[model samples]
Target: MQSLVIPLLPELPGLVHASASGTVWAITATLLASAVATPVAGRLGDMYGKRRMLLASLGLLVVGSAVAGLSTTLIPLVVGRTLQGLSAGVIPLGISIMRDELPPERLGSATATMSSSLGVGGAVGLPTAALIADHASWHLLFWISAGLGVLATALVLRLVPESQARTGGRVDLVGAAGLSTVLVCLLLAISQGADWGWASGRTLGLSVVGVAVLVAWGRWELRARQPLVDLRTSARRQVLVTNLASVMFGVATMPVRLVQPQVLQLPTATGYGLGKSLLVTGLVLTPTGLVMMAVSPLSARISAARGPKTTLMAGAVVIAAGYGLGVGLMSAIWQLMMVTTVIGAGIGLAYGAMPALIMAAVPISETGAANSLNSLMRTVGAAIASAVGGAVLAGITITVAGATVPGQNGLRVAMVIGGAAALLALAITTFVPRRRPPASADA
Candidate 1:
């Protein structure tokens, strides 16, 4: 769902009969909705039932996709995209459900696979959406998403068991509202700062208000009887460091998504550009998702034998190496593919380790909210990366046949930043406390 509309972005204004600026809301709406909804959905999942919330989320996806598929105007499309974003909590909820349903021996691999699905969907969605947009009416993109949503909903209803674990409590409406406001204010600013101007009052105002609300929200969460998020638990060494590293990993993983396509598709007249079609670009990047899936079992095994901390550190190192190689590898499609695949493997490893670390630190009852918070951290990191990468690319540009585009140096700088972020994650991961056996278990 994340990558579904990306390939079609250039044509969105015409398709929706709206200005480019207005149509941008379609993407922004999704980001805002996902940011606000993910944590709330997780909390609700823990309170109600993971399967029930998962079903509800999938239902939204189905309805949202259908709405988007049928839409011809901007408002309805934005609404549909927002609804699709509301389903972002499904991943963490799925991981939590696995904790409840799967045996300890199988849990690591199961969660790893579930976690890696995030990348897989994005990696695969690009080519699929690009192919659909090229050959068929673009509405088919949403229709197909709707169909897949329906199929997934049915399968989950029929096959997945409801989790027995529950954190029975009233919804913390105040906390939810506070967090939502903070996220909207901050994410909106970050996402739009480039268009709006970083120094613009709107951007600075939102950033200030977000931080202020966050401080108040933290205090409220610390006091609330049935808090939306357990700040105390989140403050634990393992969970805290894991989430911090998750943010850096989020930052680390985005450059490939942001820079590689442009590098691939920009006109070869620019000398450094590969000048590939969207279809070819998507195919070249597809190996990243494949490699991520392929690495899940290895990640899980490393986590099992050593610790999630070790796996996370190893993943960070691998990601840094990938980006370092990417700095000089942009001239050839094969080189870019190899770089992305390596980064994907690292992301798969890190992503899989995150849930394990969070679940291990928090009570099973808190898994949904905890995992969701971790997921939110990653989203925040990605937003930061997007903002930073956009600024860099926009700042350093070269005109190719009268059209301004990011220069090769800008792309290389972005890759370098990504590598730095990965190393920062590695440094953060070093602080994650090593796992110890349960007191009741024998050494």
Candidate 2:
């Protein structure tokens, strides 16, 4: 829904005119809110109850969707979108819940599927959003989101059991406040840097503040009795290396999402463009999401047979191969689909392995916070990719019909960069400690 807002400009003239930044806020607001809410929700889930926090996240989604569906103005829409973003913790929370509730034998596949849900939702949701926006009223998108949220909430209530594992510590208010401050500043700078000018005072100011606050936040976390994150556990060699590789993986995987649509939708008059309609572009991309789902179990099987470290390295290599293919294969729609599916499979494998790797290093009580932090690392990586990739695309542009469009070489550069990131991830994963025994039942 957030990314969908960009193309929604024509359909939402009234709301756009009402706000200075227009529907762009509808997109950025969600990103910002998701970044902030995810980690906090994880910590809260660890302290109180995963099920309770999960339910609350779902409820926010339900309410947010309904509010956005009914809104006729920009303010209400942004408010609703922000609320929806608050529910971004659902993925990590679900993973943590699975860790607590599932037996070790079943854990690999279940967590893999749960973790892949994040990518699957975005991959599948984009085309669905575009299809609805084209054929039906834009308002219907949120209504459908609301309906799904309600159904998910009910299903979870009926089927999922609350875990007894609890990190019995007082909420670290100062740490939470500091962390939120850091994230908001950093993300705002990255997300808006293009528009504001990367060198502009606002962007530079936020960047500096974010770094300073992050340092302070780290200091506070190390000292707090019950920190928002278990810094020591997170600092473990296994956990630390997994997270570093995840950041690279995040950068490696994001180019498909950022590059494919633009290339597919550009006018064929450009010679290199496919000139597909939004729905068709979406359809071409749909296989990527399906491949992720299809590959999840196989990925889990690989992790079980070898180890998640092996799985992670394999996934990174596959992603690099996919990007290498993309550099040459993007001239045709079918070719692009193949490239995306290949990359998606890699992402599915890597994402599926991440939760297993993290859980194996942290205590059960720390699952929520640990998993959340890992998720946050991926978010940071993706944001950096967006910032850096956008700059690359913007750097080499040709004016088409008086509008700026990225030159073909720009897309190629993105592919090469993505491939490099994946290879870097692969290199980093090579150093991660070999498979340890599954985390102790009582740890």
Candidate 3:
């Protein structure tokens, strides 16, 4: 939705013309809400019912999408987007269900395949939305999304089974509040920092508030019985390492997010960027989804044969190695394709193993919260990368044609940072000792 700002900005009439600050606020709210809400909903579903929660999530998305489709003003659009954000938890919730319901032998690979759906979702959404906005009414885009939501709601009713782990507990409202507050403040600071000077009161105030809230949240979790996030479980050597790696790996993964456009938009004179039209850009990048689709199951095989931990580490190393090579080779179109395929393959392998690691380290009952926290960390990492990546890109300027054009320097810097981040992920994956999970009570 936020990405729509560039193209949609020219289309909307008489709107206060959203500033970057406002846009950040909207995206921040949606991203943070989605990250926290998904796990909270997942845990709730585990205790009450996933089917009910899934339907509710889909409904919220429909309402949000419809509202966004009809929205003439920005506030209403933001409201709709926030509501839509609730759907982010669907994948994690779905993955957690496999753990609670599936047999051990079938669970690992199922978990891997389920997690890869994130990549698939993003890759699909970008192109679909791009095509609609480029060639058709943007309104049609949201309407179609709403229609899909309705269909998904119907499917969930017919297909998803209710979980039996219904346990009575007061909803962890206090814990939820604490965690949301921490995330909101920290992300606000990061998202708003560029517009507000880093040292200005807006940035400083949010940063201070964010830190204090997070610190307080930590202290509160230590004493809370049914914590929103189980910090202790999260701190386990295996869980802790995997999630720490996720944060860095997630951040590092954004180079493609940055580079894809550069590759497609760079002038043909440079002999790299296709210089294709907007629709063409989407079409060119379409191969990424197909490659990821193929890599995911293959990654699962590697995970199964080599152990999830080893698969994850090898994937991270391979990702960093690709970026390092890309620096020298990305000048050619085929080189760009090769680099993207390699990176996508690595992501498939790493993303597939992350959930397995988190599930292995925590109590089965806490999978919803744990996976959500991991999801939260992944977004936080990505958010931080986005903030810093923008700064890096802005600082480096390249000369092209008669005008001073931005060279690939920003991308190179970002990729190097990504490579370093991959190394960090490699370090984090090692502490998961590869010990076998104990036989289940059901097993």
What TM-score do all the candidates reach, one by one? 0.98, 0.97, 0.92
Q: Which stretches of candidate 1 lie over 4 Å from their true place?
A: 437-443
Put the candidates in TM-score order, highest first: 1, 2, 3
Candidate 1 C-alpha lDDT tens digits along 40-123 = 999999999999999999999999999999999999999899999999999999999998889999999999988998999999
Clashes of each: 0, 0, 2
Any idea what lDDT model 3 has? 0.74
- Score residue 384 of candidate 3 by CA lDDT: 90
lDDT of 1 at 369: 94
Q: Flag the better candidate by TM-score, 1 or 2.
A: 1
Alpha carbon deviation, residue 80, candidate 1 (Å): 0.2
Best by TM-score: 1
Cα deviation of 228 in candidate 3 (Å)?
Answer: 0.9
lDDT (Cα atoms) of all candidates against the true structure? 0.92, 0.88, 0.74
Model 2 agreement with the true structure over 245-289: per-residue lDDT tens digits:
989988987788778988999998788888888888778887877
Error at 311, model 1, angstroms: 0.4
Leading candidate by lDDT: 1
